[model samples]
Target: MTQKRLTPTQFRNQLLAVMDKKHHWAWPQFAGSAISKAQLKIHFQQEYGVYVRDFPVLLARIHGTNPPMDVRRKLAENIFEEDTGKLSLGKSHPELFLTMMAGLGFQNGAFGNLTLLPASRRYRTWLDQATLNRIWLVGTAVMTIFVEGSINDRQELLHPSKARSKREIESHIKRHPLVRFHGLSPAYMDLSRAHQLVENGHRHDAYDMVVNHTTTRQDQETILTALRKSLRLWLVYRDGIARACRLTP
Candidate 1:
């Protein structure tokens, strides 16, 4: 008998386990009262330069590739939301992030002229290379699984010990230290709004795309290899931001 391959859920869970470990770098600082406004500016500036500015294009790369109609439809929905925000919170996610940056006291047009640090530049280069040059599966995994799937409510400052309702999470997020401690207005939190609106079931969609398309053993191995490489590069990227923020880790 032929050897049994791992099921899609198993593969997805394994990948997510590794990805979760990589989040230990700066999330605590970011999601808590630890990060200052100045630190947030450094973090946002690097984030805009390295990835935020180009995320729509990354999703579009996967969309442009000849994926199945079902997958393409999902990718197109995401790209449309990223580029136009018609389906989400009514503003492009990147522009909303810049709005949050403005609330952080970064002047207008600051995000457009960002000077990327070395590790930040390397991460961007890898992102461009992976999304623009690699297979559709690789591109999808990089943009969706690696980038978008990084955050969760459980990691935040107001993380409830018990399972909280969506309304409660939103309430806590509205009073989050990033807004309350930094003195940023809640009106500029479109990024957070957009996320809460469309983030449901996203990781499942990402894994479904990969596991449904990657039929062969070789293809599965390729995705694993690419995600592993992306994770290493992502750690360096976070390290760069953490150092810039002067957080000793």
Candidate 2:
């Protein structure tokens, strides 16, 4: 039997629903915990550096002939901001957070390496391929729509809680000069900014992948499955980070 095809919007909405559910289940477990925050900061610091280093490579892939000039420029700007911001974090925070994690008896390779898990590796690989193929808009959708939305939903889940957890969160947020300075507040704010920018049609070039492609039932299903798997994997990573930090109940 042939499967019915979904529009891009339909595929996106289905992925969003799955991400929302996972975020609801995972955020509260980590948000307020001091240990969790510490671990998260460490994780973020590691990922941030790796992302910065790879930004140029990702850009090179996107800049090849045949990609729309406007799309290339917009993605270049986004990558610049992201990488430069992260570089600033590394400069200010002298403590090598990932190295510290390794010292703490965490799985040295898994926690130390930026793209340790299958999901993360898949997400990065997809981004590279999408950019190289000049389908970056689809890549942007996956990152901003699905990934950022998932993070925002998780942050919302962390909103209410009074305990050592809450205190720890407050303290970390207050003390981390880098977070406030760099505008790394709750994940919602980041995602919201990206969503608004996309909605305003500022970066339609990035969305060209999904827009120009010939739609088919199989394509729609494949995209949807990739999105769902990416989200679920990240959620699991969040949970593992929390457990590693001893934040789980």
Candidate 3:
């Protein structure tokens, strides 16, 4: 008998389920513990070393593989926003992130000397290998769908203990908790504003790109395999950071 294959909806849901479980938000260090600004720097530095920088270039690598025109268009748009921040705030996401770092009192150039932890380096290596060596659809799924989509976007916007109206919730979400709780100034939260503006339908875009482009069962399986590897490596990466932060369960 032949192996059973999933429909596009099933494939999309399977990918989404993987994302739901694999989010870095589940990391214990991010769970509202009162970490000092120094700890936050460590966390951000690890993140920047692996994925925050050169993310657009990774997306462009997939886009340049000559995928279907529709997928290429979407990928191009995503790359444009990432590279130039033309869609959201006037500054690029990387630039916005650096601004936040500055607000934390680090010099603008501190991120330059940042080094990756062992697990973080491994994760970055896998990402580079997958995006560069695998099929374009697999690269797209791993880079755009798995990396960019988040299950907790809405949940993160909610206050942990407050029962507020939608308006109140939205207002509170405008400023990142990093600014309010982490001793960082709100003046450098352009990254938060950029996310609020452009992230509403990003998850759907990731799924749709993978689903629409991957009509064959083999391609869907390939994408799923890449995502599974992504999730596994990602968990280890977070564990490395969490342990470095001395976070307790």
Candidate 4:
């Protein structure tokens, strides 16, 4: 079937529609604490190798290509927070993640030299290429909307969360898997705390940066194609990790 030309709003909806399927079959196993501690380490190791550590650098790649000034400001804010934590929690996100891991008895050295699973390697390679795309918006779409945003993105974009109070944040951390299942202290949940401080803005910025900037149908098609490709690789990546962790998917 031939494709129809769509208004920008229609095109944006299609991009978001693709995000609605980002959830993997094995997600519940991970989230529900069905995986054991050693298996959980594999999960976190793969995640750090895949995107957690280099996220700010990916945003910097887009910023380097010189997007519009307002867009640059948004990128700058996100990069600043992830790289510096000056805006939210006073430490970089990756650092906070390691701190959280410490609470679970994870050694900092364990994450130092990770060999990504085969599927994870392929997915990371795709991320490196997408962020390097000549049309900066394509890089922006993959990095921000597709990578950063989650399956809950559709709901998040439509009904952004109000900033939570301190008590609420503490309550949320008490229920975290690390805290509940692995005996991690809520004191080490600064990564989650920083996210609650800034996540809503990030979600809006992710969509608005792509949707507002993409005008031509060809760019729209290009972006949507890249996102669909990302989704497929990501699922396979999750499958690889699930198998390594011995989860039935």
Give TM-scores for every candidate, taking all chains together and pairing residue i with residue i.
0.88, 0.51, 0.88, 0.96
Give candidate 1's error at residue 143 in angstroms. 0.9
Model 1 Cα shift for residue 49 (angstroms): 1.1
Q: Superpose all Cα atoms of candidate 4 onto the true structure and report the RMSD in Å to 1 decimal.
A: 1.5
Which candidate number maximizes TM-score?
A: 4
Query: In lDDT terms, which candidate is top?
Result: 4
Q: How far is candidate 2 from the true structure (C-alpha RMSD, Å)?
A: 9.3
* Residue-level lDDT tens digits of model 2 in 73-161: 66565554444434223221112333333333444354444544443454556555544544444455555445434433333333522
**Tens-place lDDT digits, model 4, residues 94-198:** 999999888889989989999999999999999999989888988899988989888888788788788999999999999987788777888899999999988
Sequence-dependent TM-score of model 3: 0.88
How far does residue 121 in candidate 4 sit from its true spot (Å)?
Answer: 0.5
lDDT of 3 by residue, 1-249 (tens): 655778877887777777777666535456354776777778889888788888888888888788889889989988888889999777778888888888878776779977799999999999898778648888888887778766652243232233345454356545456755775665677687677677666666677788877877777777888888998999899888888888766
For each candidate in the order shown, give its overall lDDT on alpha carbons.
0.77, 0.46, 0.76, 0.89
- Candidate 1 on 74-96: residue-level lDDT in tens? 89888889888888777888888
- Flag regions of model 3 displaced more than 4 Å: 24-28, 31-33, 153-170, 173-175
RMSD in angstroms between candidate 1 and the native structure over all alpha carbons: 3.9
Q: What is the alpha-carbon lDDT of model 2 when measured against the actual structure? A: 0.46
Show model 1 residue runs off by greater than 4 Å: 1-4, 151-170
Worst 10 residues of 4 by lDDT: 1-10
Candidate 4 wrong stretches, greater than 4 Å: 1-5
